[model samples]
Target: MPTEPEPQRPPVGPAPARHELDAERLRAALVRGADPDAFYRRLDVVTETASTNADLLAAARDPGTDRRVLLAEFQHGGRGRHSRGWAGVPRAQVIVSVLLRMPGIDLADLGWLPLLAGTATVDAIRSVTGVDAELKWPNDVLVGGRKVAGILAEVAGTHPEPVVVVGIGLNVSLTEDELPVPTATSLALAGATDLDRTALAEALLRELARRWQQWYVAGWDVTGPAAAYRERCGTLGRRVRAVLPGDTELHGVAADIDEQGRIVITPDDGGEPIAVSAGDITHLRPVP
Candidate 1:
């Protein structure tokens, strides 16, 4: 009897490429052809952190600490506005915090910091990934009405000088199953061809530095920033329901954003427009 023929093996394809972010590569990209003293005094990249904001806040207590940046690959205890827990898969997001000491900046103008951050994020995402990212009021960065990034601004210290810690978390390569929520999205899900973390990070920091300089030089004037923000904000002119702090909800049409960076909503029942400083806004579609 003839021996049985050996079974054939299936063809092998190329291995999936893994993209990793390097601390030194990011630092070099951030400082290349830029003024380090004027922008980042020190840049640090950590493997994991509970919260970059918390870490920077602690560092802010020392008055001698200069403007520093902290980037985390994974955050076990990261948080957003209202202390909401925020986290993403390791090496699949941009988790960074910027610590700045504003010596004579007025407290009132500080409200625009989050908006400034949101605008910078939007610009960076658009330029890097070609995604039309927009702002969802205060600090949520949305792409096609889905949240892709979030910003949190916290006051770190106030004695010698006011130190502000602004943290941004952007989803880069998360797949559908990896999204934090149904309403959340990532650059990969949003059809971004390029997911280069180093390029994206450099673009974000460059835009932030440019906008921050303008805002700082203008003494935190919201005229320019507000206009730019309004243009990129998708919440305005849409019907929305704002969930206030006390569990009360306000349903109205988002009319405009005030100078103070508050959302001005005109009630559907002919009531006076309400300026909401802080709240969660949900866009409501109109009935046919």
Candidate 2:
């Protein structure tokens, strides 16, 4: 079988003045009109890194830490689902990783974290940039049928409390020529008039904080989040193909997102609806 080609990296050049995120301004904006003790209570922006998720996961956990959001201007080793590389020009994307600590709960419930991040991103993009964003099942955020962002969740700790790092990479101002692939798009290309990474960051964190607080207080209930996610999801009701683990493939129509956060697909084979624990899903268009 032929291997898939690696995604191209954005050509390395001097970081443009128009793309820099002001660390101070972003922190201030996040704190305004928000509870001081919110889950997304801390913020850090760096110039470069291998991956924000890796750095925060490897760092010594601070006992006083709440949810800390880490952003990097450029990432050389960033990854998405299935370990696919994600890269972009310095300061041209809203690359962030948030460390979330949840109370002890059933392991299956942890799946909601990634979905929460996806829904939050869609709402944030729509709220901040006026772009109509939608969530593809699992981890993708799409605008006008092009992928604009991806979510990756990594487990950090799970003994005393379940801790997960949710990483989100969004193309902010990449030109047409800079997209890693033809299917990818940036806010600029998606008709977002304002490309301020700071504003987008503030909006994203605020949404995450608000929704996360509700989930935490409710003991990780999926009722509200699941319903909201289904509404924002573009995958439901679409004919699709999902590549499950062990390279098995299933053709189906995305039917629903169950309480455990897995996608329930009605198989094309006339079998019963099955909830996939995890998979790489591709939405298939109807035959005209």
Candidate 3:
């Protein structure tokens, strides 16, 4: 018999600074719920993985495995939309990935999954920590205009076999020094003391499961998430600049996100609302 070739793995990025978080205890806490199976099939914990998204995608593709969630105390190679690199202190953040089998959903709709997850995550953080967390369009969550969390959604399995994996990384107790960018912030620094990573993770998972069911069952209605997202979205009604897919720039007032999850903007040059599917947005000034 010929020798089998080894599997190829994604490149490993910089590791998050190590810290202590008891993944076992967190898993136990999660499984105690009456509907544990609804939220997480099996809470697979790892000290470090290249990325939880990558791990969950792998699990979703396993021959005999059902959809599962991956909870990691540390991720050596976490990535965001557009393949942006993000790192954190191990155990100082909440990094989780939920594997979903949504066979009926169109591939185009997958782009909105990140926003759906963002809306749920913001709700959970607000409920548990009593702090104001805001969404910065598409997939970034901010606290007082500083990035506190991010989401990345990936789809695996093709045609007859389709799966969606939504990954989330939150700065639970990350310090000032760990922030890779000047505008990034953390819950602890925002006066969200008494950090409880376990409870927060459970809350996040529960919220995600609830919202995901709502979206999936409701045919991915962006109305619900868009409504909630708008309430906490810092960009809405703000003068902003958007970098479109073609690298062109447009200055406008972010009016709202439509029912289909498009960024609805009214241009400063007086055209009708422009619906954008992809872009990087920056606040220009307060809406006048």
The backbone clash count of each candidate, in order, is: 0, 0, 0
In candidate 1, which residue ranges exceed 4 Å CA deviation? 1-18, 32-38
Error of 3 at 235 (Å): 1.4
lDDT, candidates in the order shown: 0.84, 0.83, 0.77
**Better by TM-score, candidate 3 or 1:** 1
Q: What tens-digit string does per-residue lDDT give for candidate 3 at 128-166?
A: 999888888877898877788999988877556567888
Q: Which lDDT tens digits does candidate 1 get at residues 1-288?
A: 121232232233322233667777767656433444547777888889899989998998788775688988888899988988967688889999999887777778788888998999999999999999999998899887788999999998777667899999999887767778878888877778798877888789889989988887887778989998999999998888899999998888899999999999998788999999999898887533
Of the candidates numbered 1 and 3, which has the greater lDDT value? 1
For 162-220, candidate 2 gives per-residue lDDT tens digits of 78889999998887778898889888777678888988988888898888888878877
10 residues in a row with least lDDT, candidate 2: 1-10
Clashing pairs in 3: none
* CA error at residue 70 for candidate 3, angstroms: 1.1
Ten contiguous residues minimizing lDDT sum, candidate 3? 1-10
